[model samples]
Target: MSVLPLVFTSGWASGINAYAVVLLLGVFGATGLADEVPESLQRTDVLVVAGLLFLCEAVADKIPYVDSAWDTVHTVVRPVAGAVVAALLAGTSGSLPELAAGAVGGSTALMSHLVKAGTRMAVNTSPEPFSNVGVSVAEDLGVAGVITLAVFHPVAAAVVAGSLLLLGMVILVFLASRIRRFLRRRAQRREERSLAGAGRHRPHG
Candidate 1:
């Protein structure tokens, strides 16, 4: 009973088939799909691949400057995945439900991306490479754990994951704004100091 809803919800939210196709594309690139798997086993493959991809992404996202680059790449990929998931899930239901699923999946993906990106930016500001790597690895593990659980128990996982993604976005936005303001202030102070130093150095003419 539980497994059916979980599968249905995940499928509806992201179009498990579509997600599988995209995941294969990501792993093998464009050429890999030339030799197709039989239709029957494709869904199972996709679920496995999607779980792995999400785990990989979560880990890659913690890699300091590398993570920033990863996020930039995913800016395109994440939304597409979300759309696919939604479409897949929607196929099980009616039109209205399909649209709703797409919206939820896309929004959740976007929120997750933004929060992860912001955290990477903050990590970049830190000087300790070891600390950054450690944090990144931990984050990847946490994401993988949750996603694995979601795969096994999607309904509860979906609600909890979606809520966390939303909360993360809010926090990231607030922190990013503060970081920007601090940088701006620091720049202004440095400029003022430089100007004052120049004045002192000028001859009394």
Candidate 2:
């Protein structure tokens, strides 16, 4: 089987949780669980760095505004990571050229990352933190599951990942207007609260 499918799947997964994909691929490759993964990715230094970043994401992703900030920082990081992962994967087999692999990985990661960031922005309009935590957990699990499946069933994993990416993009487009209105309403509410609070604090006759 061509390694392209697995590369695409991993790239898509990286958009959601790049660190998890990196950490898992490193551990799996090092442990001989995923033979097609590159040795370079399995190095001790790579694993440690990926692990630490994954841990940081695990915590930051659960918080409301913090998650957005984290996502912002990762806008460039995730796509680059995806491209790097793809290049490494291609190097393992020499089946695909590194530039082509990198292009596929980087573009897929950007698409999924945009969907993720947009969804998070809409979720942030809500004052509660639970939704953020819930979405973050789901993304983390999705990344783990897809990567695990890619180790043994790369084709199947790619199909599933592609379907998911399509569905997410469709949903995001469908709800774009709604999300915008929701955010506007939330901002207006916050302004009203601020005005009310100011009135309460003013000196009265």
Candidate 3:
């Protein structure tokens, strides 16, 4: 029962060809379908869900202050994605299974949303608004493109997604290190100024 709705929804959203391509590519890569195969393949319902998710996020980022507003909206959207993913994974087993999947999915999405929100907040703190805006747009496009492609070719999408995740992690680490260094330098400068002021205040002796 749970699985059926999930499958149906994903399929209806993805359409046949695009969805199949996304799933197959995500799982096996383009080469995975190179060999002998049926003339036509069916798409999975999950692909549609994924595509829509990507589209929503991308669109949200485009609007001026709306990007911030959209982030708030994702507070709800991400968890839903998680729940859907969980339900689909749990199979149509039972209520307990569905609930458990939803719980896990919701939690995962929440955590991811927090991290993303925090990162953006930190980026916004920077003096360069243009950099922040440009980076934000790039991220939105990249995420949207990957999700769209993944729905059409899951195997290939999987590979691209995995690579993207890895790259994001690396970039995050680098940003964190830079932030730390910047803070340290600022602290050191403050301390030096304080010490120099104290010395100047002393009577000539």
Candidate 4:
């Protein structure tokens, strides 16, 4: 079987949590669960770094507003990770061209990351923190489930990942206005706080 489907699935998962995808794939490779995974991914150093980053993301992703900041920081990192992983997978199998696989992986990651970021922005508009934690947990489980599935059943995993990507895009479209409003309100609050601080610091006549 070709590795392209697994690559695409990984790209989708990477967008949500690159570190989790890396850690899971490394474990799969090291344990001989999946031969399609690259040996480079199974390196001890790679596993260690991915594990640490995954733990960091797990905590940061559960906090309101903080997840959005983390997502912003990963905007470039996720897509790059996806592309590199895909390229390595393609290079291993020799079934597909590496450049094409890289493009597919990178583009998919970017789109998925946008959906995640936009959704988080909309979620942050809410007052409670529980929803953020809930969403983060869901994403983590979803990434683990999909990545594991991709190893055993690549085609099925790709179908599931594609469906999720489509659903997220639809949700983003629905929440676009809400996300924009949330950003505007957040900026307004920051400006108000800044002005208040300035007033307090000003000299009295």
Best by lDDT: 4
Better candidate by lDDT, 1 or 3: 1
Better of 1 and 4 by lDDT: 4
Give a tens-digit lDDT track for model 3, residues 19-97. 2223442343223532211122223444456456555655555444445456666676655655554454444345337
3 against 4, candidate with superior lDDT: 4
Models ranked on lDDT: 4, 2, 1, 3
Off by over 4 Å in 4: 196-205
CA displacement after TM-score superposition, residue 86 of candidate 1 (Å) = 2.4
Order of all candidates by TM-score, from best down to worst?
A: 4, 2, 1, 3
Residues 42-63 of candidate 2 have per-residue lDDT tens digits of 9999899989999999999889
- Report clashes for each candidate as comma-separated counts: 10, 0, 20, 0
TM-score versus the correct structure, for each prediction: 0.57, 0.87, 0.44, 0.94
| Alpha-carbon deviation at 1 in model 2, angstroms | 2.8
Lowest lDDT 10-mer window, candidate 2?
177-186
lDDT of 2: 0.89
lDDT per model, in order?
Answer: 0.53, 0.89, 0.47, 0.93
Q: Can you tell me which runs of candidate 3 are displaced by over 4 Å?
A: 1-77, 85-115, 177-205
What candidate 2 gets wrong by more than 4 Å, as runs, is 181-205
TM-score of 3: 0.44
lDDT of 1 by residue, 1-205 (tens): 2233332333322321223334432333223432221232245566577657766755665565666677677776766666555555445434346566566666555656566667666666666667567766655444444444554465676665656656666777767864565456557868999999999999996
